[model samples]
Target: MTIKRITFLQELLGLFGLQERVHLAWISSAEAQKFVEVVTAFTEKIKSLGPNPLPAYRDAPRAALAAAAH
Candidate 1:
């Protein structure tokens, strides 16, 4: 069940081209160093990927205004 939730999140993020940007990790409280390493690696990965390409929500003011009219 836990894995299913993780997979669902991965797939959902993939729809927005963000699968690589999201991750799930399990680190014990005693594993602080491991946590730091994981965070550093993920940070570098994101840096290399550059900026997000998804369109800004600000561009949808027309849609939002239409919905608010209802």
Candidate 2:
């Protein structure tokens, strides 16, 4: 079930060229080391990908409106 959800989410993100940002992992609570490793790797991957553009895209319309007001 979780895999199905992740696949669907990946497809949705793919439409926006962000499918790589999605990750699925199964780690037991007892395995803290594994958890740290996975998180560290994912963080590095995100850093390598650079910043997300969604914030700028989301603010564009507001920026245009402000410019028009001026």
Candidate 3:
């Protein structure tokens, strides 16, 4: 149910001309440096993209995300 709820919100946000999305999770018990490296790479990937790739999706107003959510 939580996953469904978040998916819905992500889709809703996507509809607002900000569809860029990535999801990451970590267990607090894990190593700190491991977390750092992964997030660093994620940041780099986001930086490379500059901003939203699904500019068209935004125009469609989260319709894609809604389909995906289901």
Scored by TM-score, the top model is 2
TM-score of each: 0.65, 0.75, 0.42
RMSD of each: 6.5, 5.6, 8.3
After the best TM-score superposition of candidate 3, give how far the Cα of residue 65 lies from its true spot, in angstroms.
Answer: 21
Clashes in model 3: which pairs? none
Q: Candidate 3, overall lDDT? A: 0.67
lDDT of 3 by residue, 1-70 (tens): 7667766777887786344455445536467887887788878877876866566566876767787673
Query: Of the candidates shown, which would achieve the greatest lDDT relative to the real structure?
Result: 2
**Considering only N, C-alpha and C atoms within 3 Å, which residue pairs clash in candidate 1?**
none
Query: Where is model 2 more than 4 Å wrong at Cα?
Result: 61-70
lDDT (CA) per prediction: 0.81, 0.89, 0.67
Model 1 C-alpha RMSD vs. true structure (Å) is: 6.5
Which should have the higher TM-score, number 2 or number 3? 2
Model 1 C-alpha lDDT per residue in residues 1-70, reported as the tens digit of each score: 7778888998999886788887778899999999999999999999998876454446656664575474
